[model samples]
Structure formats: C-alpha cells, structure tokens
Target: MDIVLAPLATDITCAPSTAVGQGGALIEARSDREAITRWLIEYRHSPATFRHYRKEAERFVLWLEFRGLSLDALRRHHLDEFEQFLTNPLPSSHWTGPTRPRHHPRWRPFRSGLAPASRRQSLVILQGLCGWLKEAGWVTHNPFALMRDRRRRLDNAAPPVIERYFEREWWCAMWKLLDPPVEDAPQRSRFLIARRRFLFGFAYLMAPRIAEISRARMNDFRLEEGQWWWHVVGKGNKVARLPVPDDMMTLLREWRAELGLSDMPPPHDDSPVLRALDRRRGVTDNQLYRVFKDGFSMLSDALIARNWSQDHPLIEQLRRATPHWLRHTSLTHQAQSGIELRYLAMNARHARLETTARYLHAENDEWQRQQARHRLSRIE
Candidate 1:
C-alpha cells in the first residue's frame, strides 16, 4: 500500500511519494493510503531521507499485505508489528556496510550500525508517521506509541566497542589501512586510499560531519594573519570556525593543487574541500563512501594478508571503529588532555554543552575512581 502523508498547504495537495521524487520508486503504497498521506510531502525531508523512509514504508506495506490488512484497517497491533519488524529485522533484510571497510583486501564484517540503534531510529520515524496518521483521523491511536524502545547496546564481553587513539603508530596504518588503490576500483584503489585518508584525517582534526566533509568546498580553508583556519557550515545550519592544523592545511593545499584550484581563490566560503581525486568529476557522497569502502577493504586485506585476525585485540578494535568514532576519539583525547569542556565545545562545533560533554567525559582510571566513590556515597 502506498503510504501517503498529508500535503503541504490546505486542500491537502498531494505531493509525490519519495519513489516518485526519486523518479523510479517501487509501488509499495496502497492506492487509498497513497491518496491520504499529504503531511510528509509538506514536511521538510531531504531526498535521501524521504527515499529511505519510503522504502521502509514499502517494506511495512508489503508485510501488511502479507497479513491482508488494508490501509483503513491498520490498528495498534499493526503498528506494534511494524515496530517489532524494525527491531528484529529478518536476517534477509539486514544492511551491511563495508565489512573490512575496504581498509584491507580481505572481506570483514560490515558491522557499523547496531540492530538496536537502527530499530530505534526506524521506530522514531514510524512514530512520527503514525502520529501524523492519528492526528489526521486516519487512526484512533498510534500503535507505534505502544512499542518499547531499544538502546544502542554492544556486549563488551564478546564484541567490545573499539577505543584507541589514532595516535602515530595507529595513524600511519589507518590512513592507508583500508585497501590500497585497487587497479580495478571504480574510482581506482589508489585514489580511494588517499581520499579516505584525507577524510579520516580532516574529520579528526576538524570534527566536521561526514556530510560536511563531502560538501566541503575548496574556499573553506584560509591562511590569514599567519594562521590557517577552516570556516565550516556545521549541523543545524550553524557556521563555525575550526582550527586548521598546520599539517592538515599542508595536505589541504596539496589536494587543492592536485584539483587545479587556484592559490588566490574565489571569495565563496562554501566550496567543497575534499574532491574527487578521479580527475574526471567533482566528488559526491557516493565517491567519498566508495573510496572509504574500498580503502577499508584494502586496509583489512593488508592486515589479513599478514595473517591478522579479529581475534587480535588491535584488529578487533579497528574492526569496530567508524568515521564518527574518529570524531569521538578527537573529542575524548582533547578532553583527557585537560582541554576545558567549553573550549572543546567551540572547537567541536557543538551547539549544546551536553552533547559535547558526552564526547568530553574521560572514563579512565581517575574518573572511574570518582564514579565509584560517588556511587558508594549515593543515598539509597
């Protein structure tokens, strides 16, 4: 069944389904529900986000079809089922990212997102959709509201979350860690290695979002008054001033030279920073990811080629790390080094001090001892 959201303005003008916007989305919406949904079309959602939600809605529609429920027939149980479906996805529907991160040549498990985390995100979306439906009088109550939330949990006993500084020894291997340039790589393996290394490097040093990295314009970096600084448009559409490490600036300047970008550049601050090293086109998110995937595979293959396995603590830790983990590493280490939370917040581009605090808290021995004492002293 096509799940239609309420339209933008009054009279409920029907906007296109995400698939329609994509120009080739599948037929998952029921004719009736498709007719009913108008709000989602009005609500602000990116093309990618809409497309993802549409497909997920289609999945639910298909499952509803399996149970012979029409759009008008959906109740609390139906929404509950949808919630459970997201929580305990069929093995067949599981998503896999670059397992080895294309860091190495060998195939590693693509285990970046946890099932629970994904489930919660999906539920949140589902809740929003269902709440819309209920408010529109399509349903009496939202079924999704009844479902319990799941947390992002990983067992330290078996598969622990990776925690290690991308300091020197780890750093040297990490940049080239993912598979080296693949002769057969679509963007070529060599380019992938170089690009992701830059991405990994830039994010740690600057703490920009992955999207910001992909959208980073050429003119964002500047050497002014003998100091290099990066002007970044951060999440929530906020503008931020980020410190440009001298070494990172060197790499930036070099990459710009390779891009044939001018030393005396245009005045625009939003030009993409990291670009396609392919020499044919400017980079998109896909290129960034492709490079990342291939790079990780290459990196992993390098480790395995030398007979490394996940059983090794270092390899296991690397296996669990992702790009955001690098951001976390930077903030954690900065905080550990006695950087004030407020200062780190500014550098981290955090709008809220709490959000930065999560990254800033040091969980080492000294902090742990404090935690123990606090717990011991707590009033029962």
Candidate 2:
C-alpha cells in the first residue's frame, strides 16, 4: 500500500481545487484528511493532549488511507482491524517512527507493539476524535462507540498501574556521576554537563513533567509566604505552587553563578529555568529528554563496568529509563521517606490524593520484611 502524507496546514486552509497524496494519488478536495487536520489542530491548546491525540489520529488516518477509505466511511469492523494493526503493524505499513515525522523509513507507529494500556489510550483518543467529528457533522457515526474488544473496555479487568522510579541507591549513584568534581574535566565541557545535571536535578526535586521543565521560566521562582516556591504551569494548564527545597535553591544559585548571572534568579526575570547550551533560549522537551537519556546510558555503562551484571534489576531499569521515570523516582522516594500523603500530593501536583498514593505502592523493603514475619508452617 502507498503511504499517505498529511496535508500541509496551508493546503487544508487555502482554497484548492485538488490535494495530493504519496505516489501522486488523487484525493478528493476537502476530504476526511482535512477534517482530521482540523480536529488535531483544535487540540493544540493543550500541548500534551495535542501530541498524544494527534499521534493516534494520524495512525488511524494512515490506516484508513491504506484501505482506500475516508474517515466518514469507517465502521466498527474497521476499528477492529485498526486495533489488530496496532497490535502488530505490518512492516510495510510505514506508520512507525523513531520520531513521528513523515519520509523516515523507520516510521512504524509501534516500535515493538502496543501493550494493553497503550491500545486503550489509542482507542480513547480516536473515540474522542470521532465524537467531536460527529458533533461537527463531519462523520455519520462513531465507530469507536461500538468497539467490543476486551482490550478496549475500561473496567476492573484493566491492567495494574506499574509506577517506574529510581530507588534511593540508584538515585545516589546517578547523582554521584551527574555532578563530578568541577576540575575533573575542562571548564567548558564541565559547565555543559553541569547544566544538564541541574535540569535532571530540578525534575528530581520538583517532580515536574518534562514539558513543565521545558516551559519553566525564571520568573516562576518566587518567595511566597516566607518560603521559596516554584509556580509551575503543569498538565491541564493548572498552576501549582510547589515548595522548592533549600538545597535546590543553593544549586540554582551556584549554577547561575557559573552562568555569570546574578546570585539569585530575579523575581522579574523571564528567562527559562533550564536554558539551552547556546544560552539564548529555553531547552525544548526533546533536548531535555536527550540529556537525561544520555545520563541514564552513562550510569548504566558505569554500573556494568563496575561488575554489576546486566541482569541486575537496577542496571536493567536504567537501560530502559526515560525522563518521566525520574519524576516517578522523586515522588516514590519522597513517599518512602515518610512524607505525609497530603503534603506529598501537593508537592507532586497530583489533582487527586489517590494519584499520589500510587507512589505508596512502590515496593517497600521494610514493609515487606515486617510482613515476612508470618510464614506457613511445614508439615514434618
């Protein structure tokens, strides 16, 4: 099947007699592709949702094109086929990507395959898209509403929420390597690595999402009610006043000094909290991800060199680490350290206490040891 590239934004908005797809296939002007583009654009107000929903919608659209159908013509059976495709996308499907850009040969939507949780997420996004399109009179019906697969169901049978985070030992090891002696390397190269460490350190201490960190401005740091706090714009555009630890403030000051800035971040300063290496603008989410990823790789290699087996849980976990895992690590460590749930919830910026309680489920060695007191008696 020929791959379908999305119409450029201007192509959809401009008055055009015809549109083109890959291989010069003629698509009817103002078709389902345009409708899908409009739907995805409406979500641009929320960055996270825009990225996620656009992905699911794009994959679905590509599949529809492969079948030579339009979005309005999709039915329940088509969605079932889509689900199957998501589970194991055909190698030739060209719906995959390391980065979701078109024209990349490695672009399959799924790297390995979607887990049950990921499949549910994809279905939910499409369901919402279809619902919106139906309301707008673009589609005749919502096929997702009639999808009956067990994987698409939202009920008690759903898979457990597994929180991935670093333990205390792992955190310490990362920190040790993240910030080495200033003189250990050339001053120029050392400063660059130090900047990255501060970014990861901010995430660890504040537990902010990568997006929040990316958009974090110096003005967001302020002294409120006699305590230093970061006024972060988190998911859902909700503003959270997270308490900044004293040590973090010290590091901030030190890093700024290294940058030749003022001893403290001025209340009126509008610069990013995490500036790019160029020192002119804030780092993007992708740049921040690469920094943490590089750190994870370095730490994993260090451990392996120290004779830690590749099969060791900590080593293996590091190998699979993503930037968000650091947020989980921070919150989980705080819960383990006996921080009160109510306070931890506020610190974590979790809208619900139950969400924060997920960290309490992190395997507690002491709790497990105490529970081990009860054992079944063996028959002689």
Candidate 2 RMSD to the correct structure: 5.3
Which residues of candidate 2, in runs, are more than 4 Å off? 7-11, 14-29, 100-112, 149-152, 155-159, 362-376
Stretch of 10 with least lDDT, candidate 1? 150-159
Per-residue CA lDDT of model 1 for 1-380, tens digit only, reads 23222211223434443332223333333353463345345333443454446544545555565567765576756765665655544432232234332224342222333365455555566666766655554545565554443222211122222244454456566655533344566544455455666666676677665666776676777667877777777665678877777768766655555455665345574556665554545676556655554555556667777887757655665555555666777777677779898889898876667667665445556678877766445586
Query: lDDT for every model?
Result: 0.56, 0.75
Error of 2 at 146 (Å): 2.2
Error of 2 at 8 (Å): 7.0
Model 2 Cα lDDT, one tens digit per residue, 255-310: 78767789888888898878776676788887888888888888889888888899
Write down the RMSD of all candidates, one decimal each. Answer: 9.3, 5.3
Number of clashes recorded per candidate? 56, 7
Question: Any residue pairs clashing in model 2, and if so which?
Answer: 95-108, 95-109, 96-107, 96-108, 96-109, 97-107, 97-108
TM-scores for all candidates: the values are 0.66, 0.84
| Model 1 segments more than 4 A misplaced | 1-39, 42-62, 70-80, 91-114, 147-193, 223-226, 260-271, 277-280, 317-322, 363-367, 370-380
